[model samples]
Target: MIEAFDLFSVEQVAFGTGRWEQLGGFARRLGSRSLLVTNAGDPGDGGLVDRTLRHLEQSGVAATCFRQRGEPRVEDVERAVAAAREQGCDLVVALGGGSAIDAGKAVAGLLTNGGSVLDYMEVIGQGRKLTRPATPWIAVPTTAGTGAEVTRNAVIGCPEKRFKASLRSELLLPRIALIDPSLAVGVPPHVTACSGMDALCQLIESFTSNRAQPLTDAWALHGIRLAARALPRAVAAGDDVEARTQMALAAVISGVALTNVGLGAVHGFAAPAGANYPIPHGAVCARLLPPVIEANVAALHAEDRDHPGLAKYAEIGRALTGTCDAASDAIEAGIGCLNDLVDQLQIPPLRQFGLTPEGFADLVSLARKASSMRYNPVTLSDAALTEILQKAW
Candidate 1:
């Protein structure tokens, strides 16, 4: 009954062991000149970036690098745009985590239709549309989370707005996203848990979001199963290549699903929390997952004792915990997962990022405005949101 609206999009996928070898060919086809965007010298990631550039060189493409030393900042985007324009590079390749990928999305969007990045930023700016397709951008994920490579929207946090939003458009998708799990193997345990949760959240939220479509549901369910199995293995032992490959698949699947479907409460607050505090994005999401699920379940029950959504929660429960016919067990499954993950990795709460009880008031207010919340089954009030924060805290 839900297949009324037909959607079609393009995503060039190159994935496997040694898939990095294909980067040169994709870059050459995109353009001779390439902008390799990355975070500043993550000692672990720096060498990989160099090798990717060499691949481009071998492919007969010239590469100019724009290093993001910190998180992706407005100035970084500005400079990347300038570098790409100055070099006349027709292709943008993001090589690291979400920061570089988002920066590349911004650069590609602005490359064709020249304007301030703010103009295109959803909610914070004029919310202008990206009418033209950005230059051919290739996403190479070096991390196992965020799935920024497959998403059509780029999340940019704006401190001035006290939140973040996506630079969303069909045109913003990468021409090709290269998923080589070998590149994600060296991730530290803490980063792995956090990013893995982020991937997990994307899949779970996409599956449950009000905007989910059939195609998106396929990605979400597959991503959910793969992540649930592989994330723990990847965290327990980082060098497991098969686990990493499955995780890579999960992240990419979640990314594509979130790109096509949407997300729920956990992500609705991630940008606000990340913008206001130094807390990592995935950490914020990881902490919020259980309470948000409980809240959603409680809200659903309150709205209707017999809603289909309640049954969906039961479905999620069986998927996560293998529990039978227990709708509220989904909330339990979410809690068990979060607690097990946190204890395994011991992720810190918002307070570690300096969000005292006093700061949370403002954070809740800011989080309330984030557009991602619109997809949540129930729109949480200030008090309700604070309750979730307090529980996570």
Candidate 2:
């Protein structure tokens, strides 16, 4: 018998090759003025940002642009929120990678809630719940990763505290998630590889999470299969529309699955590591994926042989390798496939990002406190977590 579960997702999603053209209409429905959030490095120059501006103008919707430099910092959200309020903007549209979307999400949420980001953020703040609906927001992803468009939480980095945490609330879910695979074309190969691997890791980890439910399991497996088949193609040929579309869909599915069922050790470690290091979030997840999988499988085998995650890992292995072998062999084969993919994608080791043995204790201690870790398939000891970190290093 299946256990009870809950699923949360965006209110609406518009996905296709030409869906970007509908952004203006969507924004107009929400408000006449919008705050357009994009990457700091995007110089317009007739690029995607310029195109978006044109779309909003054509629909008679005025926009003020806000560029987010990196991951959503608490101050970034504050600045954007102030800009939106100053401009009397009623709608928020984020058009870039995960950072831009997360920044926009936080801005939208705080616009109505009327407080600092710290008031609603988890782990490093007051953890207050958002009592009001966020300003209407739309998410347009320029990369096929993160699925931040549909998620309800925004990750905000606070450099002063040397940690990252989430500002979470159901109100943060976007009014519309507009995904156009054509926008992902021309993304650098390295970015594609890292983002694709992040999607894959989320799928695998969510599938094996203790919170896995029937719907999430289905979404996870389907996404895992799509990522396994499309990631290499997307990395090899950035202009491949089919590969980009598949990856985009897989990423959205991953976001949905993880939002409902939660994630495991990879994300657990990614939280603290990303906050403390200069490494990119996707790259950190890519480097740790294989080692975390191995550690989880080992811990499960040694402790709870009958845990459902063991079979789930075998299923993931089959998805990755297209193999119909015994569970043990398939699990190993799946892990081998991940290692090979990491090598093929040229994902750098954790050590390359300045992580050393001396820091393992702190990382493990922080990881234990990560909300994602509670959803791991098995309870891993400090020694096991340390070993995984060392191997990734």
Candidate 3:
């Protein structure tokens, strides 16, 4: 059976040095009552939040704030939706990193539909479809990663299931995407690296996904090129406008690619690790990327060069690093880039999250059950999965 690929896009992107001021008019255009969704208790975001609130208030829009701190769980979305309903908000405005935006997506999705957030959750819950229209939503992305502003999927982990899943629907795509480079300026070095890797991985994984389409491939290849040139520089110097601008664009383009083409093993494995471990999603992906690449390449090569995933690997390597040396060298360089980012950012290991080899022993099962794993070009054995974990370790 043929599966059709759907292309969704940003309604508007406001990107520049100081573009938050533009929010006043746009926020007014959306609705009079705005539920301002923000990151929970980040001291740095307070001033930005204040600026946004001032703009909304001056525009005569009544606003309520929903502060979400960590990666939003199902309950967080429910709580925010309830607050929005109580406040009788007409719109949901997400303003922060991917987590905050994801929270807002969930809140917007549930406000009109009035269903359990869990009922529409991925893997864990009933996995019900959301047929109703979500509340009007404007996404304001403060970070240069995830491109959650434009993505149709919102990944929320369910602790009860011990596996992560995404709430994906065309209806859940934000009504508008507000991308402001200035918003990413003061992000910490660690965040810059992690988020940047998340962008980098999306570009690579999407370009290489089994279901890649011509449009998404164009987006991913270009995203890969931008990431190679800008991500490291952005991590080193947050205030560098040129680098920041490119990475910011890369984030959105990569989001566009992943939304249309989907992702592969890196995401497949990371979701479970995220659900089970304390490690952040980007870090886990960054750690796993090279090993997974190498494993897939090796699995392809050692089989008399008859492996199926080779073309995707070749394209991704050439796109990101440019000029495939040898397949092994290309694979190694990919791994090297990840290590360089980890070293440059000082990201910790899986063990830091209490994921010992024994802990990871259980990951094979978790990894096997993950949805993203289904997209991998080759079907890896349990032993291959364990090997990838060991290499990542």
Go through the candidates in order and give each one's C-alpha lDDT.
Answer: 0.81, 0.90, 0.81
Backbone clashes (count) for model 1? 0
Q: What are the models' TM-scores?
A: 0.95, 0.98, 0.93
- Pull out the clashing pairs in model 1: none
The candidate that wins on TM-score is 2
- Alpha-carbon runs more than 4 Å astray in model 2: 40-44
Model 3: colliding residue pairs: 40-68
| Model 3: lowest-lDDT 10 consecutive positions | 40-49
Superposed by TM-score, candidate 2 places the C-alpha of residue 39 at a distance from the truth, in angstroms, of 1.2
Estimate, for each residue in 117-236, the C-alpha lDDT of model 2 and write its tens digit.
999888888999999999999999988878888888899999887778899888999999999998899799999998888889989988998888999899889999999999999999
Kindly list the per-residue Cα lDDT of model 3 for residues 212-273, writing each as its tens digit.
Answer: 77788887888888887787888888898788889888999988888877888888889889
Ranking of models by lDDT: 2, 3, 1
**How would you encode candidate 1's per-residue C-alpha lDDT over 85-150 as one tens digit per residue?**
999998898888888888888888889978988888887878888899898899888888899988
Using lDDT, give the best candidate's number: 2
Against the correct fold, how does model 1 do in TM-score?
0.95
Of candidates 3 and 2, the better by lDDT: 2
